[model samples]
Structures are given as C-alpha cells and as structure tokens.
Target: MSDQPVNLVSVNTAPERAKKVIGTVIENVKDKYTIVHAGNSATIDGVKPLLLSIQPPPGILFCASMWTPEEQAEIQQIARETIPGIRTHAIPTGLQVQVGPDGVIKYLMERIDDIMKV
Candidate 1:
C-alpha cells in the first residue's frame, strides 16, 4: 500500500469538528495511511491554499460541505482541473458526522484503506 495521504476537505466553519474527525481517521488507520485534514475551502480559488500547502498523493478526497449546488460544482471543477488525477467523494452537509456517530469516519477510512490496498 502506498503511504500517500487521503485529503479531506470541508467548510472552514467547523474547525474543531474537522480536527476531531481527522484525528479519528488517522488513529483508526493506525497511521498506516496519512489522513490530511486539507482544511476548509469552499471556492475554486480557495483550493489554492490546499494545493500549495500539501503535495497530496494520488488518493481520495473526502469533501464535506454545506455550499450551494453551484458552489459545489465550481469547487469540483476547480479541484479536477487543479489536482488533475485524483478521486473525490463528496459528502453533502446533511450526511457529514463531525462528531458523535462514527459512520462517516468509518466510511471514509474504509474507502481510503481500500484505495491504498490497490
């Protein structure tokens, strides 16, 4: 398996919750995979910070956001253009579990693990 990191992007509004989720995913994977909390960015330009800050490997992007459909599409387009070849899994705001139930975290971890094994 590759040691490449899985980037998880979400809205900047919930920093603490994002941190917790990032930590949980890292711990759950036992650090076998690098889980990067790519931090919050909901715009096409906002993605610049993530691209500049992290040289993320070719892995999944777990995007959880509360943006409008238009905004989501723009972000997705920007990500595809900027990152080129990486898989993205968008988790709508309604399904995101920042805290409490570990369903989201579990799902993400599983997806990442499966990808890594490939």
Candidate 2:
C-alpha cells in the first residue's frame, strides 16, 4: 500500500442537462486509474452522492476534503464501504487558506509525496 500510485479525477460540469458529470481523470495521474463521474442525484442511506459505474472496482479511490470534518468522514466511509480493497486519501481542499489552483495543487502534491514516503 505504501508504494501505491495516486489518482486524480476532474469533474467538470456541462451546459446540457444530460451527461452532467464527465468521467475524466487527469491523463498524467498514472498509467492506470479509475474515473467515476456520477450524476448529481443524492445517494441512499447517507452515502456519498457520487456513484461508481465502472466494472471491476478500482484499486484506489481518492477523495478531497469537504467543508466540514463530518462531511469528510461521510465521504471517506462511502469510499471505504463501496470498494472492498480500495485505499483512499483525502487532502486539504484549500478552503481554509482560500488558495488558488496552483497553491492547492502544490500543497496537495506535497502531501501526497509525504504520504508515499510513509
């Protein structure tokens, strides 16, 4: 698990009512990664809103921080329960310091590097 690679998925919204979430991951994330861009509909039993449509579950599921710790916990729980063997890591969402994309990306990369060293 220590040597596992990280994945980064970008969820961009579209103007059309159909196909809300474009399941696309950053090409440079790794040689292998999973991108599950589910619809905006709510999930049952307090689970995360997003759903996984891909067959043969992904090896890793990456999550970002939520506005509150409780929300973060809920997302983490959802990922953990949904995929039996998938490992998940959540970094800061840059909301506290209100940083721009570059700063957020730098900080996230640093955090991931630190995690990989462990």
lDDT values for all models: 0.59, 0.40
Return the TM-score for candidate 2, rounded to 2 decimals: 0.50
lDDT of 1 by residue, 1-40 (tens): 3455566565434667667776787778764766666665
**For candidate 2, lDDT tens digit of each residue in 9-115?**
22212212112212222232334332333332222333333436534444444444323555555666776687665555554553324764445455544554443
Q: Which candidate wins on TM-score?
A: 1
TM-score of each: 0.66, 0.50
Pairs clashing within candidate 2: none
Which candidate gets the maximum lDDT versus the true structure? 1
Worst ten-residue run, lDDT, model 2? 12-21
| Backbone clash total, candidate 1 | 0
Tell me the lDDT of model 2 at 78: 75
